[model samples]
Target: MNLYQNDDTTIQIDALNMLKLKKNILLKGPTGSGKTKLAETLRHELDRPMHSINCSVDLDAESLLGFKTIEIKGGESVITFVEGPVIQAMKQGHLLYIDEINMAKPETLPILNGVLDFRRTITNPFTGEVITADDNFAVIAAINVGYVGTLPMNEALKNRFVVIDMDYISGETLKNVIRTQTLLEDETLIEQLGKFNKDLITMAEQGQISEEASSIRALLDLCDLTTIMPVERAVKRAIVDKLEDDREQQAIINAMELTF
Candidate 1:
C-alpha cells in the first residue's frame, strides 16, 4: 500500500494543491504506475469518503448513475431507485474516483459533462432528478494511454481537470518499495529484482514486451512469490506466464536468466 516518493518528486503535494483549489485531477500514467494509489492517498489526506468507479468498455449509464431494483415491503413488491457512485459521491460531497477514465465507451462519457464542469450538476436519466453536487464534491480520474482497448479522451472532457503524469519508480525508490512490500530481506536479492524490473521496463518501452509484464505490481507479486518459491519459478508464474506470446515469454525468461 506504500507509494515510494523520491525527494525530487512533489506529486502528492501538487495533487493536493489542485484538489484544494476545487480543480478536478486527471492522472495520466502507464499501468501500475500508482495513479490509483495517488488518488487514494489524496482522498485519505483530504479526509473525504471516496466512491470509486472502474471504467471499462462495458461501463454503462446504469453503472454511473443508478439502477432500480424490486423489493418486497409489507408483502408487496416495490421498485426502489439505487444511486450510483456518481450520484452518491455528489450528494454526499465525497471524492469521486474514476479509474481508467479513458476505458469507458466514448458515447457513454458525455453524461458527465455537467457534473465535471463548472455546473457540478447531473440530471438522473432514470429518476428525472436534477442533483446538484455539494460544494466539497471533487473528482480524481486516472488513465493509461496507448494501452489496448483504451480510447482517446475527448478534448472537451480532458480540459476539465489538471493533468498529472506518473511514471515508474526506479533505483533506490523501487528497491525500497520491493523491500517494504515483500517478505524479502536480503539486500542483494532485492537489488537483483530491482535491476530485473528496470530491464523489463526497458524491454517494454522498446516494444519487446507488453507493459503489463513490466508493471511494478507484477514485480511485487514476483517478490512475494519468491518468499515461498524459487526466483526462477516465481518469474515464470508471476511475469512470464502472464503473457501468451511465446516470443514475449522467452524474452522474459532470457531476462530472468541474465538477471539471476
Candidate 2:
C-alpha cells in the first residue's frame, strides 16, 4: 500500500511508535494535509480493519454508539440494536478513525470520554451494556483547527491522545506526489504546478488566502484538469471557482498567471 510521503520522517515515525504502544493518537493539521491518509497508512501497517466516523455537528449518540431498529426475523417483528463504528471497533479490535472530530457537537462527544481514556470502555446508552475495547483496539482522531463550523475540542478530549501536527508536503516530495497522483504528464507543467502550489501555501501562511484555496487536494484536482483543459481554465475551475470570495479568486488567478 502507498503510505504518506513527506520530506521529514519524524511525523510518520512518531505516529507508528505511538500506535504500536496502543496509544490513541490525534492528528492535528490543516485541511487536506493528509491526516486521513496518515491514519489509513497506520491502519494498513498494523494490519487491522478500520471503522471510521466522520464527525459533524449532527453527530449524536446514535451515530457514535448504535441505534435500535425493528427487524422482521423468523416471521416476527423484533427490535435489535445495531452497533456503530465505536462499538464495532472495540468488539472487533479494529482501528477507529474519527475524521474532523472537533466538528462533532460538544455535548455528543463526551460519550466517548471513557472509551478514549484509560478506562477503554463505555456503557451503550441504547442497550445499557458495558462494552470494553479489545486488547488491540485503538483510536486515531484528526482535527483541523481554525476552520468554520468547528468547535474547540474539549481540553479533556484533547488530552486523550498523542497529538501529531501535520503540515503540507513541499519541494521535490510534493512534485513527486503530483506526478504519481495525477494524470498530467508534462514535466514542465508539473514543475509549474508545484511552484503554484508553493505560492498558494505561502499566501495562506501570510493570511492573504484561506487555507482551503491552497489545499494540496485542490492542487491535485487542478493537475488532473490540466490533462484535458488549458492550464488557465483548469486553474479557474479547480482552484479559483472553489472560493466564493471574489478577492480570493482574483488572488489565485494572479498567482496562477505568475507561475504559468
Candidate 3:
C-alpha cells in the first residue's frame, strides 16, 4: 500500500530512502501518525516479504526465537524447530517488522539488539545451536513515544538502529487523503470537518485529550460506514467523539446542527 502520496510531506522521503540503504530502522511516532503504514510501504519498496511481530510485555526471548518440538508418530522428534516471526523473517531474509518493540520485555531487548548488530545470529535455547541470519535479512521497528506501561529500552540497544521520528501530516495533506479515500459528494462538509480536525489536533497537542483530532484513516472509515448509517451520527461517532471532550462535544453537537 502506498500510504504516502507523491505530493505528501517530504519528511517521509528521508525515512523511505534510508530503509533502502540500511537494514535497521527505529520508527518513533505518536499512536495514529502512520508509522506502521509507512513501514508497510517500505516493505513494498524493499521487495521483501514482510512479517510483523506485535511486541508486548509477554514477549520474551523464547517467544521471539524458535522453540523446540517433540513428537512420537514415528520416533522422538526432539529439537524439531517451530519458528517465531523473527526466526521466519531471518530464514527468508524478509522485512522483519517489530511493532512496539519498546514494549517488549526487558529480557527480549538484548536478543533483538544482537540481531540488529554484528551478531546476526541467535543460539537456539533448546538445541544449543547457533544459526546465522541471511545477509539480506532486515529489521524495522515502529514504537510509540510517551506511551504508558512500556519499558525503557536499553540505551545500548537503542544506539544500534537508526531512529526516525514521524510526525502528523499537514491539514491539506490529510484532507486530500480523506477525499481521495472517500467518494464523498460534499467537499464543503469535508472542508468543515478538516477545519474541526485541525482545531482538535491543536488541542490534543496541548495534552487536552488522549488522541489527535482524527486520523486520515478514521475519516476513511467514516466514509466507508456512512452508507450504512446516518451521515451525521456516523461522523459524530467516528470522528467527533474521539476529537473532543464533553464540553467540546456539546459545542460540536450544536455546531453540527448548523451544518444541515
Candidate 4:
C-alpha cells in the first residue's frame, strides 16, 4: 500500500490515470502481465472496498448478479435473495474486479451490459429490483488473449470500456520487481531468470511451449524452490512438470538445456 513512484513508471500508472478519467477500462494482455495486481493497487489507492471475482466458464447471470438461498427465519424455511459480488460492489460503491472475464459465460456477460454503460443499472430478476449503480461503483475486467479455454468477449462488452493493453515489463523495471519480490540482490541470477522468462515466452509465442509453463508465478515459484533444492529439479517441478502435453514438455526441457 505504501508503494510510490518517483518517475511514475510501469503500465500500472497508465491504467490508474485512464480509469480516473474514464471510470471503466478493460485490461487486456498476456498472462502474468500483472493486471490483477494493478487492479488491487488501484483499489487501495481509491480506498474503496473491493469485491474480487475470479470468473469461470460456468459463471452465469444468476450466480454473478444474485441468487436465492434458503434461510430458516422461523419454523418454515424461506428463500432469501442474496447479492453476489457484482451487486454488492454496485450497491456499496466499491471496485468490482472481474479477473479473466473472458472466462465468464456468454449469457452471464449480458447481465453487466446495462451496468457498464450510461444506463448504469442492473435488473435483478429474482427481486425484480432495478439497482442503479452508485457514483463510486466501477468495473475493471482483465483478460488474457489466446489462453486455452478462454473465449473472446462479445463486442457489446468490449464497447463498454476503454481498452488498456498491459504486458510484461523489462530492463531495470523488471529487475526492481524481482529484487523486491524475491528479496535477493543477485543481479546475475535475476538477469538470467529474466532472459529465461523471455525465452520461455518466445517459445510460447512460437507454439513450442504453453504459456502456463512460463508465467511470472512459475518463475517466482522456481526461485522459491531453489532455496530448498537444486535449480534443475526446481525448474522441472515449478514449470516443466506442469505441462501435460509431451511435445510441450520436451520443448521446454530442450530450451532449459540450451539456456542453462
Q: Backbone collision count in every prediction?
A: 0, 0, 0, 0
> Sorted by lDDT, highest first, which candidate order results?
1, 2, 4, 3
* lDDT for model 4: 0.78
> Which candidate, 1 or 4, has the higher lDDT?
1
In candidate 1, position 150 carries an lDDT of 93
Find the candidate with the highest TM-score and give its number: 1
Name the weakest run of 10 consecutive residues (lDDT summed) in model 3.
1-10
lDDT of 1: 0.89
Q: lDDT of each model, Cα atoms only?
A: 0.89, 0.86, 0.70, 0.78
Which lDDT tens digits does candidate 2 get at residues 1-260? 23354445567777888987878999888986878767876877889999999999889889988899999999999999999999999999999999999899878898899999889999998899999999999999999988889998888888888888888877776776777778988999988888898899988988888988888778889999999999999998988887888888899999988887
lDDT for 232 (candidate 4): 77
* Candidate 2 Cα errors over 4 Å, as ranges: 1-9
The 10 consecutive residues of candidate 2 with the worst lDDT sum are 1-10
Q: Write the per-residue lDDT of candidate 4 for residues 1-260, one digit (tens) a residue.
A: 22323255545666677666646778887876667667877887789888888889778776677789999896899999989998999899898988898888776788788888888898898899989988888889999888788887888988888877867655566566677667446677778777877888888778788767767778778776766776778789999888889998888777777767
Strongest candidate by lDDT = 1
Which lDDT value does model 2 have at 45?
Answer: 81
Q: Which stretches of model 1 miss by more than 4 angstroms?
A: 1-7
Q: Which pairs clash (backbone N, Cα, C closer than 3 Å) in model 2?
A: none
lDDT per residue as tens, model 3, 47-94: 789888888988876677867677665665554677887878888888
Tens digits of per-residue lDDT, candidate 1, 1-260, equal: 34546467678888888888889999988986767767877888889999999999999999999999999999999999999999999999999999999999888988999999989999999989999999889999999989888999888899998888888878887787777767888888898998999899999989999999988779889989998999999999998888989999999999999999
